[model samples]
Target chain A: MIELQNVAMSYGGGDLFSEISLKLAPGSFHFLTGPSGAGKTTLLKLCYAELMPSAGHVSFMGRDVRTMGRDDIAALRGRIGVVHQDCQFLDHLSVAENVALPLTVARRPLDARELMELLGWVGLKAQADALPPQLSGGERQRAALARAVIMSPDVLLADEPTGNLDWDMSLRLLTLLVELNRMGKTVLIATHDLNLIRAAKQQVSARVLRIANRRLQLAGADL
Target chain B: MRAVLALIRADGRGVDRVVPPTGHTAWLTVLSAAAMAFLAVFALALALATGRLADRWSDALARSATIRISAPVDQMPTQTRAVLEVLATTPGIADYRALDEDEMRALLDPWFGPDLPVETLPLPQLIALTETAEGVDGEGLRLRLAAEAPGAVLDDHTRWRRPLVSAAERLRFLGLISLVLIGGATAGMITLAAQAALAANGQVIRVLRLVGARDSYIARAFVRRFTLRGLSGAALGTVLGMIAVALLPEADAAGGFLTGLGFEGAGWLWPMMIPPMAAAVAFAATRAAALRMLRGIR
Candidate 1:
């Protein structure tokens, strides 16, 4: 439900990317591939209204992101879950508490049973009470995924969701994204991992979009 | 107003999960609030005390004047009688009487003691004049006294009394100004403390924001916390200040201005307002700092 047309991003008096166009439709999965510093993260930021485009328009759902107020942006964000590469968590909070944060911020009631089930789905049920700093990299990635989907968002955006994980961990995390898409959630992931992309294709059909020379293009069966 | 009500209702619900209570800044906020409120109690006491003093001085001096007959010993009685006759015809004067020897001696007791030989000295005769609520015209009274008794001088006490009243009024103004400064300082300190908390918990705030939390939600967590701390600390300070005021030496005729600096009667209720006022200041300061910091994010 996020659309960007002719979007350009600039920083330090120069263009980081320009004339990029993409649309994330319902229940469709897409992978964004780019090398280091090619503005993959910045593109993800634009989709979530974290960064406004230097040119062109970005719309969240049906409304323009530029015209939305602060409260309206917050409400829109609740419908779109995001997973950062760093897997940011309130370290003072336990793993289970961190997973339930989206509902907490939205002022919704916490369902202990649902939280446990989500933790179980992410293979983090055993580490529910552990702190973020205490969790391993793969565990943190899974926990972040659990947090992202806890709200049952209509769209999920993950930036390098498996960047710090091993192949097995990465594939496990990829399967989680596939399961979410199968459940009718639109998913867009930004990464440069070709092997993960090939692994993902074997289980689910996902369009691959590559960012090269400051432009977004649909890559054909390259991996 | 509805937004304020929502913030209030949303205060402690799930705030601890997002912005946990930071210890050092919490202690700083409480201590600063307590100290500022303690100082404010004295400021309030000074204001109330000076207010009462001004009213008392104005009322006691407003409706009265004195006429001093300074004739020679042989002609003093004659001039005194003439002055009395002039006062008798004065329209606004409700009553007039010459002070007897014992009354004059008692008036000078504190300064001259009880051993002064009044009959040996060429002392002046003092006549006390009481006026109606409207009061007598000083110029009219002076002209009448000059015609009837050449040596009589009408002293309305305005020269000395005006300065005293003005000084008390200025003191009251100073006390009020001090209260304002104290409130401003309290707000400044709480704002700094809130900023420090925001900076220290930058990651926490970013995580909360990423999870679809509104700016008001994040701000309410801090605002509610600091407001409660200010209330508790100021409440303690107010009680201690009231106890300290109550223990001051009681006012007496001899104690003069210093003894009257403490609260009297209904004035005791004034210091009780400091706690809630401190809480309000904390609420405003923390909310402003929180919102400003949140705008800088994302």
Candidate 2:
């Protein structure tokens, strides 16, 4: 579980967000909604220790991010899968290889059967040999999802997971996140897409946190 | 050591997937390594050859002295006998013999023609003294020679020979310095290439880091790649250098000093170390560069 209390982030001469407190409990699903340039990505980066809170404390599993060493951060990252908005993949590597990258980075043995099964779960088994550029946007997102879950991470933090997907593809991706949560993995997704959030709520109950005016607030019954 | 072992062994499990190969940087590393190793070969050869030359000069000049007794033809025989008697009592003198007229002409044959009229020329009588390992005191021998044979001058070859020995020693020093500089340049070039590769593959590195890859894991990929390139290129360069050296006219007593500027006998084994050394330099350079770049990111 990741916790941030009274956290604030800033860049250059302006504050991105301030005095934010949030707790991502075990197996809890949350949707982080914010308009463009509202520090959703910055908040997610703080969860993974990619960016430190300028003020207050951000802790992962009861340890402060400020005190964690580089190696410790990497080890912590292995337990938390992050799906970027862009679905960054090594462009030169095949889709299958990219999905199996976490296992490679963690220096674990690659079971080809398990990798194929994971790819099959993401519906990308057929495009396993294709490069990232060769895959459709939906396929790339799925591949990124497959890569994120390859390690069976305890927590999954995704930024704009359905940003470029069609309605059906977004639903399918939401179903994957729902499936992961059902399998005891905590999930937090950052996006401005209210429809995707509404779609996800029916499958799995998710609290929505909205970032506005440099603060995070639980949304009212406006939905 | 354990960490190094881990880094090396991790490659076997295929960590290379993270940072995809950049062709231009790979070629740059190999080419720089080869060029550096080639220059290193020449530097090493120069050092070894000059070392041998210095040794030859030192050993040949250290124990010997020449006695020149110049006198009128009537007094030449008596002066030569007096110089010989004085040399016989010299403590470090192993052997002494007056050069015959024909021997002196042979020494002068390079300057004057071989058919020069040696008997009619008023050349001085030259006595060659081979000294013991302990070596004669030139000062003591010179004083004795002056008393016994006034026309005799003792030449220990130190005046002219000192400069030759110093030149050889300086050349050897310079060659070694050149070798060090070449190695340093190779490391610099490899570091730049590694940095460029890391920069070009920034997204790849970012993805890898996001997936929980440690710095060492990322660096090992580049280190193994650059190290292999360096080794292969340096191996080729070393072989080429050896061939070039081998083809140089073989040094012999007749071929003189110019021919001696290469490896002789067991000395050929020295150049074989260059490839491995270049590989080590590449490994260190790339690892440092990769680690530095990784630290800068995230």
Question: How do all models score by TM-score?
Answer: 0.96, 0.97
Compared with the true structure, the alpha-carbon lDDT of candidate 2 equals 0.89
Model 2 TM-score is 0.97
User: Native contacts retained per candidate?
Assistant: 0.70, 0.80
Evaluated with DockQ, which candidate comes out highest? 2
Can you tell me which runs of candidate 2 are displaced by over 4 Å?
B1-13
lDDT of 2 by residue, B18-45 (tens): 6677879888777778888888888999
* Clashes (candidate 1): 0
lDDT of 2 at B147: 89
lDDT (C-alpha) at residue A166 in model 1: 94
lDDT of 1: 0.89
DockQ measured for candidate 2 = 0.84
